[model samples]
Target: MKKTEKIITNKIKINDRFWGRYLEVVRNHVIPYQWDALNDCLPDASPSHAIENFRIAAGESSDDYYGMVFQDSDLAKWLEAVSYSLENEPNPELEKIADEVIALFGRAQGEDGYLNTYYMVKEPNNRWTNIRDNHELYCAGHLIEAAVAYYQATGKKQFLDIMCKYADYIDSVFGPEEDKLKGYPGHQEIELALVKLYDVTGKEKYLDLSKYFIDERGKQPHYFDIEKKKRNDTKPFWFNDDYAYHQAHKSVREQKEAVGHAVRATYMYTAMTDLAVKTKDESLKKACEELWNNVTQKQMYITGGIGSMEFGEAFSFNYDLPNDLSYTETCASIALVFWANRMLQLDANNKYADVMELALYNGTISGMDLDGKKFFYVNPLEVQPEACEKRKDKKHVKSVRQKWFGCACCPPNLARLIASIGHYIYSQKEKEVFVHLYMGNETTVQIANNNVKLTQQTNYPWDGNVSMIVTPEREESFTVAFRIPGWAKGTVMKLNGEIIDHIPLIKNGYVYINRKWQENDHIELSFPMVVERIQSNPQVRHNVGKVALQRGPVVYCLEQVDNGENLHGLILPRNAELKANYNPDLLEGVVSITGDAERIDQTNWNDSLYRPVEDKTTSVQMKAIPYYAWCNRESGEMIVWVNEKR
Candidate 1:
């Protein structure tokens, strides 16, 4: 079996108009602000006693443990973001802070390698007793990820060693062995993190442990049930023993549709793909493919958001996506990106990369405000401040981003993803390099026993023109594949100032260019950046007669600040001439979509709840901004889907 290839995070440097600013915000603003939030220094926001829990466990503070049981994962995610920031540019103060945190972790860890501040400080004897809801293993998984990332970024092994010890302890407690407890995480994360540990340490036990967790899930006489029975606790399960909520309903190989909590489902799928590639498990690979098709074809939003309902923060029936009541949690989309990238590794298909890019540009980044200090846990397609405030069903929807949350998972998750944006741009095999995303960056890839330097310059998402220069250490024949996005049409290519008149070799979704490279060969690609009106399938009842606006990879939304107070009453004409204009002075410089449309006038209703139907209409010019940039200015009603006057 071929070894799975990974992008070396430290080798790639991002410098793009779209992503560069996000990276800078993650480094300079989000990271420091989150650090303060973790330390409980932000008096204006909800208290996050994450760091204090650690201090209590380390015996540095005598305070009682406060916050959610999963609070420790917040710090873990922040640490992972810090590692990525340090990889982009070193800061001594940040490093010192991370180092001090690591020292505290060492002090907090028990002699048996048991870690997790919740159990350590609050319930010492109850460790591993409630794997169903305690989130102990889930927290451990995040800590392991932070450890691996920090070690990779700074060449520091102390954090890694601490996590390894903790992992070893976990490995001892749960496995197929008669003495070990047969349990898996209710929240599936440690399985994926263990794969990262195995990649770095080359320890087969880590890989085996990850496989054990995946294989043991959803088996007969489920582990959650067994654990519950052993405790003899009569409390009803929060999910009413709906094992699918945790994705533990059946074996992973037999599960076809995406079910359960959106984040947990995606995380488990990511680990399954990772293990399938590593161990050459054909069944696992097939299961992943079926699940992938189910998600992207039936369950996904146009913005690549998942998890339709807020009831369980989980997926609903197929094509049941509601524009206003959607609970597209930010972390779910980020995890979707993670799963998609791993799927790309398993197969260099453009479908995965396309969804990855969709989530990055629209759903995931929409969770964070432009300044990066504020964040949204739910990325709704349409929002009305009054509805959110007055309606019980719309209570979860927020028209504006908040400073912080008591749950607080999405903020740090967004931070780490934006900080590590370089990892998604390009991937490599022994002699093949696949460009998954069009981001301006420079990086070196080892191909065919030689170093190849590649630099890309593009104003993607705003303009579709891309220019690339390839420089290898010496003349060598290799293949470079550029992804032709699914949405892009009438693409043109030029190699070294000469047009390729003949049909180019296209595979999956990439144009393949294989040749013996010279010192400074140039490649240029142009994709027609035309505004498109997208209509949902008839099965999606909510969007049947409506259309959404999209240009390039960006999804556009109509805001009250630009359109009017009643955005829902606006109707887009069937033949409206939609134009894309780059407004540097608006919404932090976005290409806004403008068109002449009509709105139903409600001026003469005159205190009547019900009135005779009439076409009391007025002409208005509609403006749509990038979905990610909405609500960054004034707070008002926002709608992605506009009624079409067909």
Candidate 2:
């Protein structure tokens, strides 16, 4: 497969009608609140103690490691988000704090260049002893990502050199060489991060290290098992004997199913795709293709959520999607986005972007609240307040977003992803520019031997009209491929107020418009936005007789706040006339759907669980808000798929 180059986030400035406000909130509100959380200034939030851990490790304070083994990642991820934000909106104060933090990081490094606070402060001798359960390498992955972002955003090499030292140290410790330890991370993040590190520095060693980790994972005589027996620690840890939990059931090349923790598996798959495209490894590419099909075909929800059960935050089986008991961790969906986007880079396929957009608009954004303060770690398709309260298994499914979590991975992950969304919109390969996502943004692309600035305007996920104005330094010939989203039916593309009726160059999921561009050359796209009814595969037992409402990329849900109680007693008629209406005062001004439906009256039914008797039904109107907007109002029953009236 041929790979396309991407226009990095730094070159893109967002003025999106839909995502612009969200990005602003992330920069202004979320970043500050999270910084406060890291410093333990937020009352009632989980104590991060992240900054204190760094202080101790840097010898600035007399204390020990105060949080989880991976507590350092919170600050690392925050710095990454700050780096992206700094590229667009420069803040001198934030840059000063970041420089101070980088200096502390330099001081915190040991002589050998290892930089984990937990082991450095607490288990100095036990470094790399329990890589299976501990997150030393996982934390290093986030730090490396932070370093790359910081270097790119600010052109500062202080933190980059620190991470490089750490990576060099890791390269020396673990590899295929006889002198190195045959070990990989229990969590799968560093694999992808190493690829990013390699890309930035053009370091062959880092690329070889990432491939070594990917190739060595889940091989015979399993290194994780060998490492576990070597430790001989009686203390219980979150280690599963089933190697599938970490996606090590077999070597990655031999693995076909998406198993284990959804986030870990997706991260590993993402790295594998990266290596596959970079190295042109057909075997690895085939495995990725099969796994991708397995995930989207059977395991995924209509909201693009994965990880069915919370047991291991893992997949159960094919066609085993459950609604209320789902453990669709927000991070997992974000990882899905990561994996899907990489797949698109390998080959410009609309199928990949379809899932990416689905998750971004619904499953992924649903992780955070509209105010950008509270966040949901687990996003379930259906929510029952009583179930979330009383049932132990359903505890992961929260009716409302929480301030913080003990693990606290999803919030920072969401923040970083949201802050760096510009990278996902456009990709460049030589003279070809692919517009994969639609949003209002102005970006400069280095293509056709010229820096071409393009401005996009759209109110996407609600409306389907898009306008693009192209400005070039001089008249240049280039091909601009606009992604026709799979959901966009009957789409029309126009150039300079004239309809494009000639033979259109359509491939994968994009329409290629090739021409010599001039300043202010305009183009327009029209994708009709209408209420859509979606259904699941028959094998999905929970949604066997149901239909879901959708408009463009946004999935709509019937919440108790809008539909009243006894939500299950209502049914959307098969021939119901659904209408799309935009209300400015509703849920941050979302386009809502209204339709005619039947409400069953159970007042005359006996008090038995099941009765073979007729029940009165009344014709009524039902309203549904976007799935991401659910639980924002008064907590009540909420469902994505509703029964179709007979």
Error of 2 at 197 (Å): 0.9
TM-score of each: 0.98, 0.97
Alpha-carbon shift of residue 418 in model 1 (angstroms): 0.3
Per-residue alpha-carbon lDDT of candidate 2 for residues 1-646, written as tens digits (9 for 90 to 100)? 3443654566789988678888898889999999999988989989899999989988999976788999999999999989988886789998998999899999999988999999988898999888987899999999999999999999999999999999999999999889989999999999999999988898989989999999988887988767777888655446455778888878898887888899999999999999998888989999999999999998999898999989999998999999999999999999999999999878889999999999999999899998889999999988888889999988888888899988889898999889888989988778888888999999887765688999999988778999999999999999998888888888888899998853357888788888999999998999889888898899999998898988998998999888888788888988899999889888888999998999987676568788876857899899999998887778789999898975
Q: Evaluate residue 372 in candidate 1 and report its C-alpha lDDT on the 0 to 100 scale.
A: 92
lDDT of 1 by residue, 457-552 (tens): 999889999999999999999999899898998889999999774245888988889999988899999989999999998999999899999998
Q: Write down the worst ten-residue block by lDDT for model 1.
A: 1-10
The candidate that wins on lDDT is 1
Q: Output candidate 1 Cα RMSD.
A: 1.1
Clash pairs (backbone) in predicted model 2: none
What value does the lDDT take at residue 48 in candidate 1? 97
